[model samples]
Target: MTVCAYLALGSNMGDRAEQLRQAIHKLNRRDGIRVIRISPVYETEPVGFVDQEAFLNMVIAVESDLAPEKLLETALAVEQELGRVRTVRWGPRTIDIDLLLYGDKMLQLEHLTIPHPSMTERAFVLVPLRDVWEGGALPVLNRPVDEYLRLLPQENKGVQKWGTIGWETGFDHSES
Candidate 1:
């Protein structure tokens, strides 16, 4: 069976935009995973650890035959391949890929959590999430993503649209 999954991608180190594009391309090349739609990239301030550079963030929708766990594994692999280092919690990194939602299934395990625990609170996640979700109710939240986005505190939700991704704007491969 195929499941629709929403993934959140971000980067703050090195070439942020290019890292995102590469990650997406890698995912698209993976078996059982097909890129469907992608949200516009957003430049956002750091969350937990505010000392790092701003992050370029976006969300993607994919149709995949892989189970949630397998999908998470693929995401982690892509992060590692992109040279992500987890030296600090929420610290700067080359790439960060999170499995935000998986076909309305609620899951909690030792290493992963569906509906990403902090998704509701972070603008970096919610802003791009709303872009692809378009006010659709999330499985875990049972409320439209935009509703959650609106509930966030204005002062701290430092999300700003950076620009369109190459795929979204039909840019040449060389430009991406």
Candidate 2:
């Protein structure tokens, strides 16, 4: 069976746009994954790691035969390959990939959760998510993604579309 999943991509450590593009490529190249759609990249201010640079972010839609756990593992691997180091919570990094949703599955375990815990709270996640999912409903929330976006406070700081990039694009760092 194919599982529709949403992934949020972010980078601030190096070539932000290139890191996102490379991460997308790595995701599509995974054995059981297929890229369906990708939102235009957005530039957003740093959230948690306030001392670091802002992040270039995007969201990807994918149909995957891989299970949630395997998918999470693959995302972690991509982060590692991009030179992500877990030095601090939300610290600056070369790449950061998050599994935002996995079909309608409501997962709650030690390391994973569907409809990511903080997805709705951030404009970075909500804006790109709405771009790709506009009228689509979130698996766990059972409400349209746009509705959730509407409910949030309108304080999007520096989140705007830079341009479009794809899976086939070579991973070259594009300065943000």
**RMSDs, each prediction?**
3.0, 4.6
Q: What is the RMSD of candidate 1? A: 3.0
List lDDT for all candidates, in order: 0.88, 0.83
- Candidate 1, residues 109-163, lDDT tens digits: the string is 9988887888898888988888788447887689987788789889768888899
Point out where model 2 deviates above 4 Å: 156-158, 166-176
TM-scores of all candidate predictions against the true structure: 0.93, 0.89
Candidate 1 accuracy as TM-score: 0.93
Residue 107 of candidate 1: its Cα lDDT? 92
Best by TM-score: 1
Candidate 1: pairs in clash: none
Model 2: number of backbone collisions: 0
Which one wins on lDDT? Answer: 1
Mind giving the per-residue lDDT tens digits that candidate 2 earns over 1-176? Answer: 89889999999976788888788878777888887878888888887669989888889888899999999999999999989998989889899899999988989989998879999888889788887774477767878777777787776444777777654343322323
